[model samples]
Target: MSLANIFDTAASAMSANTVRLNTTASNLANAESAASSIDETYRARHPVFAAVRQQVEALSFDTLDAGQTETQGVQVLGIVESDAPLQQRYEPDHPLANEEGYVFYPNVNAVEEMTNMISSSKAYQMNVEVMNSAKTMMQRLLTLGQ
Candidate 1:
């Protein structure tokens, strides 16, 4: 891989991590939300990621080295709602309670969401560090001519 590709890779990672953090935050925010029906309740959302690949010309003049594949970075496929069951509680007096005296809560797990948040944050920080390191390396390379 070329040195310049480092920036693109890191940038893509940072973007993917940002999406993960946002989804985690949203899950946490709706963790306590209540709904009158299971269909209306919020579901824990998660982002799916996929590896992005690119075809590059081989560095050699040989015909066998014509096309090579390299991973560019990560791409978010889409956000998916968790299949976990929603929380149902008997709260007869609650305003949002259904006729059956039950309230439906989102399936979000606070602890899991918190863990995801932390992981995403750490990943983002790591990407930032990678970018900084790449920048420093590029600067040092500039001085190699002198």
Candidate 2:
């Protein structure tokens, strides 16, 4: 890969991490939400990612090979809701309690959601650092020709 491709790869990774952080935040926000029925409860969400293979461009005679593998970068496919069952709590006095003396609550774990958020944020920061480092390296290379 060329030096300039570093920036593209880092940018795509940062975008994917942003999606992850947003989904984590959403999960945390609804962690305490209660529902009268499982169908009405909030479901945990997660971001899906896939590698985007870049199209191979024509190569010059000097560097051309009989066959070459395509390069890939990170990509966010979409967000998916977790299928975990809702937690049932016996809260007869709860306002949203059902006739069976049970209150259906979302399966979102606040601690796990918080952990995911932190990890996603840290990953994004690291990607930023990578892009910055690449920028610095490119600048240094340019100075050599001065």
Candidate 3:
């Protein structure tokens, strides 16, 4: 793949990771929220990603008629809420308790969210490194003429 394509792929991956980090932050922020009803409770959200591909023209003169497909980058399809059951607690004294003295909490798992945050951060860093490496390679190539 060309260096320009490398930059594009890394940028797309970084964008997707940003979305992941945002969703994780949202889930963590609502982890402790309480609601009187199930419908009012927050649900853990996660972003969906898919590979993006594009057709490229054949570079070789021998197979100019043939087309090639390459992965451009990752794309965020959408955010989805977890289907796992919410936490129901019997907190009769709680202000948001329902008629049954139950308060509903989000399905968000703090440990899981924290882990996801760390993973997303690492992925972003890796992309940055990839871009930097590409830049250095391009610079070195330019210096070869001197």
Candidate 4:
């Protein structure tokens, strides 16, 4: 791995964390939403991530290597809805209540979502710090020859 690659890795991590934060916000937004039917109920969502790997380009004779792969960054595979059971409540007087007098709520847990948001934000901040540190190191390297 090269120093420049650190920036790429940190950037990818920040992007993934942004997606995570978005999903957490979405889950929290729909946490209280109620639906009359299972199909209409909103479900908590989460983003899946995978590490991106690439073959390092051989820039010189010394760089040539066999079967060498480096992790470039992170990739967001996709967003998935949680399969946990939805909240079922007996609210007969509720306008959206079903015939059985039960209103279905999203499976989103507010506390969990909040915690996820905090975690994502911290990850993003850490990535930012990483990028800054890389930048500083690069700058110092450039000044060394001056």
> Of the candidates shown, which would achieve the greatest lDDT relative to the real structure?
3
Native-structure RMSD, model 3? 2.9
Query: What lDDT tens digits, residue by residue, belong to model 2 across residues 7-125?
Result: 87888999999889988988888888988887898999998999897766545567656544356579988888888888999999999999998988888888889889889999999
Query: Scored by CA lDDT, what does every candidate get?
Result: 0.91, 0.86, 0.94, 0.91
Candidate 4 local lDDT, 1-146, one digit each (tens): 87878988999999999999989988888899999999999999999999898877544446555444365899999999899999999999999999999999999988889999999999999999999999999999999988
TM-scores, in order shown?
0.90, 0.87, 0.90, 0.90
**Residue-level lDDT tens digits of model 3 in 21-60:** 9999999999999999999999999999999988665565
Q: Is candidate 2 or candidate 4 better by TM-score?
A: 4
Expressed as tens digits, the lDDT of each residue in 12-118 for candidate 1 is 99999999999999999899999999889999999999999887655555655566646499999999999999999999999999999999999998988999999
lDDT of 4 at 23: 91
By summed lDDT, the worst window of 10 consecutive residues in model 2 runs over: 63-72
Q: Give per-residue lDDT, candidate 3, residue 23.
A: 96
Could you tell which candidate, 2 or 3, scores higher by TM-score? 3
RMSD of each: 3.3, 3.0, 2.9, 2.7
Worst 10-residue lDDT window, candidate 1: 60-69
